[model samples]
Every structure is written in structure tokens, then in C-alpha cells.
Target: MKSQRHRITDLRTRRRELQRRAATYRASKGTPYPVEVHLLLGQTYLDPASWDALLHSRGPAVALRRARFAPRYDQLLRRLEEAITRYERP
Candidate 1:
């Protein structure tokens, strides 16, 4: 039997693979991943551009990852948004 962490990690791994495949498909065929998977891996690293791309892809899997990882990514986005909002406030 797999440990819970292992199971979660496996799930996240699958999600990542799907995300990668989806990105490739979107680039080559202009489409998103066929299957939408949830459960984000805690250690995955994505740059802002990739994050934005994923968000804009509008795939359910992306949505799931967004929801799961929002707590982490959202903090950074929120801070950036706040800084922009403050800086623009002449």
C-alpha cells in the first residue's frame, strides 16, 4: 500500500504530466488537456508566464490546480497586485 503522501504525490505527478501535455497540445493543436486533474504538488515551480498561460487555458484541470495552489500563488499575485495598485496611486 502506498503512503498517503505517495498517493498524493502520484496524483500530483499525473496532474503535472497532463498539464505539460496540454501545453504542448495548445501550442501544436490549439487545444487544452483532455482530462482535468486536481491536487497540486507542493513543490512544483511555475513562472508567472506559465501560471498565466495555465489560467488562460481555461481547462478544468488548470482550474483544479489553480484552486489547489491558489493559496500559495495567490499570495504572490495579491502582493504584486497590491504593489501595482499602490504604485499607480500617484
Candidate 2:
């Protein structure tokens, strides 16, 4: 049986480890959006061009990935607009 102080110390250590994992993931992976999305965000309509074009230039796999990215990116932009509208009311 662990003492109360030891249990508390163990729990705190566990929490620190979990926080470190979370921080590392966010730093490395840039959560909520992929590197492809980030790269495209500044470009016209999030780059990618058209499905057929992408398939031709890049490949079927990249075309497929970018195809899914457009709508999700637009949805994220819409949500950002909504949040701005809701929060920035004068």
C-alpha cells in the first residue's frame, strides 16, 4: 500500500509525463491540420488545382489526399469567420 504522499507524487509525475507527450505532439505534428494543408493555405483555393490535374502532376494518391483537404479547409475557414464574427462584435 502506498502512502498518501507517495501516491500524490506518483500522480503528479504521471501528469507531467502526459503533458510532455502532449507538448511534443503539438510541436512536431502541428495538430488539427496537415503539413500539406499548411503549405496550401496561402495559395489560391488551397492549391491542389483540380483532381485530374493533381492526379496528373503529382499522382493518384496525392490527388486523393488533396481532394479531401479542400472541403475541410473551407469548413475551417468558415468556422474561423463565425468565431471572429461572434467575438469581435462592436
Candidate 3:
């Protein structure tokens, strides 16, 4: 078992890694992903329902644009299929 101190250190390291990835992603010039996708990607029944509610309440979109986002849904579905295939019984 990892000591509490070790777990905290790991958490800090993971946080830094995520921050670095975010910075790199921001620097990239590819078609930008809406910050809202992370919100939309989140499922309401999950442990993070409070966060999902907050994100869903506020839109990165203007009043003219609805907060609907399905951009990553297909890709996520594909990945879900792949994962299910991996666990399928012979």
C-alpha cells in the first residue's frame, strides 16, 4: 500500500502533468475544442454531478447558440465499443 505522503506526492505530480498537457493543448492551433465538451462529456449520474450541473448551467455559448454539444459523442461511442469488444467472452 502506498503511504499517505506518497499518495499526496503522486496527486501533485499528476496535477502538474495535467496542467502541462493543458498548456500544450492551448498552444496547439488545431480546431479548438469547446471547454464545454468536458462538461457535456460528463454523465449526470456520476460522482461529479454537482460539477456537471454547474457546467451545464452556464454555457460557453451565447444566447443565440444552445448549449448542446455532440462533437465528441461519436468518438466516445467508438471507444466504448472497442472497450466492450476487449472484454467480450470468447
Model 2 steric clash pairs: none
Name the candidate that leads on lDDT: 1
* Candidate 1 residue-wise lDDT, 1-83, digit = tens: 76333443444454465446435545775543222211222234465576555446566776676556645554544443343
Give one digit per residue, the lDDT tens place, for model 3 in 1-90.
Answer: 763334334433443444444345546634333444333223211234532443344434421122122223334433433433333323
Report clash pairs, candidate 3. none
Q: What ranges in model 2 sit over 4 Å off?
A: 1-57
Alpha-carbon shift of residue 10 in model 2 (angstroms)? 50
C-alpha RMSD between model 2 and the true structure: 20.3
Better of 1 and 2 by TM-score: 2
RMSD of each: 16.3, 20.3, 14.9
CA deviation > 4 Å runs, candidate 3:
30-33, 36-90
How many residue pairs clash (N, CA or C atoms closer than 3 angstroms) in each of the candidate models, in the order given? 0, 0, 0
Compared with the true structure, the alpha-carbon lDDT of candidate 3 equals 0.37
Pairs of residues at least 3 apart in sequence or in different chains that clash in candidate 1? none
Candidate 1: segments with Cα more than 4 A from true spot? 31-90
Error (Å) of candidate 3 at residue 25 is: 1.4
